[model samples]
Target: MNKYIEIIKNAYTGYWNYLKHELISINHWDNYFYGLLCISLIVWLLEICFPWRKNQSIFRNDFWLDTFYMFFNFFLLNLIVLIALSNTAAQFLNDILSFIGISISSFQLFDVDDLPKVLGLFIFFVVGDFIQWNTHRLLHRIPWLWNFHKVHHSVKEMGFAAHLRYHWMEPVIYKSLLYIPMAIIGGFDAQDVAIVHFFNIAIGHLNHANLGWNYGPLKYIFNNPKMHIWHHAKNLPEHSKYGINYGLTLSLWDYLFNTAHIPYNGRDIELGFEGDENFPKDFIHQELYPLSKK
Candidate 1:
């Protein structure tokens, strides 16, 4: 009865939530998925509304690629939650705190503290990406990890969908290793974690977009597309410019790490690794051939 009531309340609350220009209603449970769908559609529409000269090919690829990633990440995220991590990213946080001699819980950090829950979640999203940027850069630089990272870079185009071309093995590292450490330390609740996921998806989409929009000073600190495109460039010298724009919300780490690249010419350069020229084109080949035996 309570579950049914909650659903009714959430459904009615969405209109007010939409009017406020907020992504989700604070009081609604299912608003997260609905909000994500709305935002994803908006992103696709924006790609059509504001076309890019050099990335028309990218626009074409995005239709199928984005669809593929949407479903792909959906399945993988659920799998990790159900099977791999057992829905206890918070527990992993506690374990990491124990190792570090800190006594913190994700719930306690978000709930029992004077800090606002929204702010706490924002920090979690930012900090986790900081770690992700360095770890992702390492994956590209290190030979063994590069084997997996290369799969993502193998795409010969740039679009919103290109972001989802990551190797299948990445989620194991992203969820279990990259995210769990922060979850254990932060002690955020389910809502806080959900907001971080939202931020990740939104920022990730922006990073791979072809639109030349800039967030003014925010561009200096965030992983906007301008800097991210260079990360996917075909040139090895350019590709090594990897760790820049490490921050999803703010590029502080990129500046600190000296990996941030901001282009002045306003051009969309060619993307992907040279090795992918001979690579397969079909979805199956794109998804599997990279990891397969030759």
Candidate 2:
């Protein structure tokens, strides 16, 4: 009993320490929160001006659940798990290299200072987005991943806030996959990652907002609100016909891979899965429902 108590106490202390480090060491809380605020406002205005589904309410279906998801993601999701995972991976890799007498610091690919700030920013966006694009594809194609990903798609009435609706497990899986590619690229520090995250926060909301513009020629390059709405469309025959439009910030990948799908004026496509009515309404149920019996 004493041994078990000590083990529990140690785990609690470790968790508390991690929580403190995450809150203090990782700057950019202002950038993330305020950036999302501005994006949400812009998207909200656009939705009011040009909503795709006129009948969908300002307080749409599952609005509170989405709000819960947004706050949870902001407050909890990306902090402890990602930081701990990276630190542990770093320590493990360092230990292995130390055994082999190999110093990892000798291999910085690009000097972050030498590169133009704009170029660094672009590279940050492209690399991070590529990782996310692949993650999105895996979530749709892999059955096990699909179980967790279904929470996002279950939101039948899509809105700007729905951008943050995702399983908490997502960062763990995606961040684990991102580590190798990030190491290969090198020279990107926390600031570079923060900027890309800021850009994503804005762009992500815009893509999910109810606005109905495809941005003409730009649609081929960037994933716009219209193209993304179709991604959530349940009744669209192409859900099975073609696994369509899984790009994160850019539509270029979907075009290159032949997963892109946007018919002319395709704004009327139905959102959410056909039988998603069986999906739970509350936050707790949605989190656990995916783990229930097959």
Candidate 3:
């Protein structure tokens, strides 16, 4: 009980300190707080310059709402709740493993130091993306998870900020599943993960932006706006009942697993699900939406 209380208190303090640093300090260019703003600005400019949907307004539907989601999910919820919780969970798991006379370090599949830094980072990126890809499919296929994921699909219009408009629980789910696999292939540092993280953020913003870029032949490798817009299509084909285009950073997994589907240009396809009209529009309501019986 005391340990839990200490954890909570530390979480509160850590949240405030991190928040202050992120907001006030400009020393680190790689900080996510700044990175998110920079990426959003760049993508917004791209959307303004070469919008696929010419008729879509610059301040499209729920633009501000999605922007709020971006900061909330990335910083507020993450620093305040997830950081301490994840640390405590890791410690608890390690303690349990110690009691069982096992060391988590022994589970490493290979020493990342043995490979070149670039190759190691590439492997880490691909493996991490594959884990997220599978986790994304679970969000659509599982009823309980789909309830939370619906907050993302409720987007009526696509924008770069829309990329981060997902329920906070999503990180918990994605990171929890990613932890084991990533740890098993260990030796990469925070900088390595940050490189991949920021890159994925950029790609994700592009994928959700109102930019009709297919990357032509590269479409089979990297996910693009044209390919990802179909992922949010309200009317999916019967064959893809659970959803399709479950790619995170790369479309290679989708193609390899036979889940890739692009029947048309998808520039003007209707977004959201069947009953999206009734979905909550406000942030607070949407946060509690998944817990509701409805």
Candidate 4:
């Protein structure tokens, strides 16, 4: 009982300190709070200047709702709950492993420490993206996961901020699956991969933005607005009952695995799923909608 209490206390303190550092520290320019703000502002400016749907309003439908989701999922919820919970979970997992005499540190596929810095970072980035891509597919294929993922697909109009409009359970799922694989390929610090993280965040914003960019030849390598819009299209391909274009950062997986689908320019495609007209429009209801018996 004392051990559990200590873990909970330490988790809250550690996350609070980390949050404070992220908010005020200037020593690290790679802070996520500022990074998210900068990227959001840049992409939003692009959308305003060059919106693919010319008739779409600057304040598109559900715009503020999605904005709230962005900050809520990114910072507010993390500060209040997720950060502490994740920390506690990590400590508990470590304790369980210790009890079984299993040292996770002893089981690396390869240590990034011995490799060249860029190569190590590249390996970590690719593997992490691949994991997310597969997890994304599961979110569509599995019924229960899709219920949680519905918050993201409920977007009636896509925009840059829509990138982060997901159920809070998503991070729990993504990070839980990510932990073991990342642990096995250890020695790289979070700071070491900040560049990749920021780049992915930018791509994610672009993918959800009201832009029509397909990246031309790079469409095969990277995900872009054109390819990703179809991911949110109201009408899924008859063949793709689960979903299509499951790529999170890279399009390579979708192309290689044959899930890629873009029959034509998707600029005017209607967004959301079949029953989306009935989906919750407010933040509070959207969060709880997934967990409801309905």
Candidate 5:
């Protein structure tokens, strides 16, 4: 009881303090709201100007759920992270590692300061993207994981808002897994992390958007709408592969891993799984639906 009380107290303190300083720094969170509004505005314009599917409605199905997910990811999930950390990420990771008998300090053997900032940032981006890509791939390939991932792919009308649509458990799984390797590295570039967050928000919105910007040859370099739409294709090339294009932020990982699957005609591609039209449209049921044995 005492421990739980302390955790709640600390969470309150941390959240209040976070709210106080959130606007003063871009890294704090002002950038998040800024990026959200900007990206949403830009996408809304582009979506109206150059829609890939002319028949789809601007409002879209599951729009409210996706809206909830955006706030959930940005605010609630982050609050969960803070609570899980008890205000300390390194200690939280060390505690988890200790429980598994893999005892290790949250420090690198060598100093990252010796490397140039740009080089260090490059390493961060590559390593982080690879970890995210692996997590995404696992979500599609594993049966249990697929249950949670199906929420995102259930939308027939893909758009900017669809990017954040995900099961609540996804951040818990992905972030916890990511912190394992990242904490071991003993370095964090706040600027690079911010840049990546901005880039991710922009690219994520564009990729799930109804707009048709293939970026041509650049499609091989970055994950674009054309490439990503195929990922949500109803009848994928094979069941073994689940769906195509698991890459996040970068397509290089998919290319190297031989998971890249793009068909010739990605236009007006059917989205969502077959025989799942009766899937729960409500938020609470959707989360529970994944874990239900029935």
Candidate 6:
């Protein structure tokens, strides 16, 4: 086992060394600004092409809410990761899986590398979303878990902010489990992970976008924005399509699980909770209200 591990570790290191020495150089600042611009442009195109809803518009009241959500979501995640990496002890704790037979080194686990970057990004999104779909389906099937899961369903609207509207605990459960396991298993390097995560951000936005792109077969395979909008529907039958396009890149799981919903009308039926029309928007209220005595 140790020999196998060492081999894997060496291969991983060798790949990085080769990349650093032979791969094309990247200007981090220029790349970051350009990356953001490209993402924004793609999002805009997606909105124009495959709008999840028929009348979706970027200028709606929810625009500001989603913008704020994007800001805070990035801020919170960066702050948490920074804090986790600040101290040597904290950093080790953040990467405890290595000590337990897993071998992704700290630096290698989080840096965004190129080449494998695109594939890794989409794969991570799919894996994470698969976890989410199963958990969500389980939540609906078992009333106990519904208490926590319903917080997401409670959102009465579908927009970029809807992506951020999830209860904080939701992320703690889903993201921690998925991320920790991936880190320990060790596939892509840190750079690969970052690039993939950036890809995920675009997918997340596209999933909740108010766009109109419907690339027929592509819609069937990939979870287009419209498909996700339907997932946000409040109707019982519509909500039952919970598993379709659970991941950002693929909908195969939804098909496998028999939760894939094919829209005959090419539009999302409706939005919000089944019976609860007065879901609150305040962060504290969203966090605390779901658990309070009903």
**Number of the top-ranking candidate, with lDDT as the measure:** 3
Q: Write the per-residue lDDT of candidate 4 for residues 1-294, one digit (tens) a residue.
A: 687778678777877788788888766778988889899999999999999998989889889988888888888787776776776777788888999998778777899989999899899999999999999999999899999999999998899989999999999999888888888999878787788889999999999998989899999999999999999999998999899999999999999999999999999999999998899888889989987944
Q: Kindly list the per-residue Cα lDDT of model 5 for residues 214-254, writing each as its tens digit.
A: 78788777898888888898887764457678877888787
What are the lDDT figures for the candidates, one per model?
Answer: 0.61, 0.75, 0.91, 0.90, 0.77, 0.56
RMSD (CA, Å), candidate 4 to true, equals 1.5
lDDT, candidate 1, equals 0.61
Residue-level lDDT for 242 in candidate 1: 41
What does candidate 1's lDDT look like per residue over 1-294, in tens digits? 454445445544543454353343456753555656766777666766775545375347535765676656654444333233433444555667889887654334333234676676666766677777667766766666666766677665566666666766666566565554563455567667676677777777776666666677877667676677767766635554443444545566777867766655334566677676776666566567646743
Off by over 4 Å in 2: 1-30, 93-108, 236-242
Candidate 4 off by > 4 Å: none
RMSD of each: 7.8, 4.6, 1.5, 1.5, 3.1, 8.8
lDDT of 3 by residue, 1-294 (tens): 677678778877878887888888888867878888999999999999999999999999999999999998888887767877776777677778999998889898897879999999999999999999999999999999999999999999999999999998898898888877877998988788789999999999999999999898999999999999999999999999999999988999999999999998898889999899999999999999999945
Task: Please give the lDDT score at residue 186 for candidate 4.
Answer: 92
**How does model 5 fare in lDDT?**
0.77
Span of ten consecutive residues with least summed lDDT in model 5: 81-90
Candidate 5, superposed: residue stretches over 4 Å from native: 1-8, 20-30, 80-93, 96-103, 106-110, 239-241
Candidate 2 all-Cα RMSD: 4.6
TM-score, cand. 5 vs. native: 0.86
Clash count per candidate? 8, 0, 0, 0, 0, 18
Instruction: Work out the TM-score per prediction.
Output: 0.73, 0.82, 0.95, 0.95, 0.86, 0.66
How does candidate 6 fare on TM-score?
Answer: 0.66
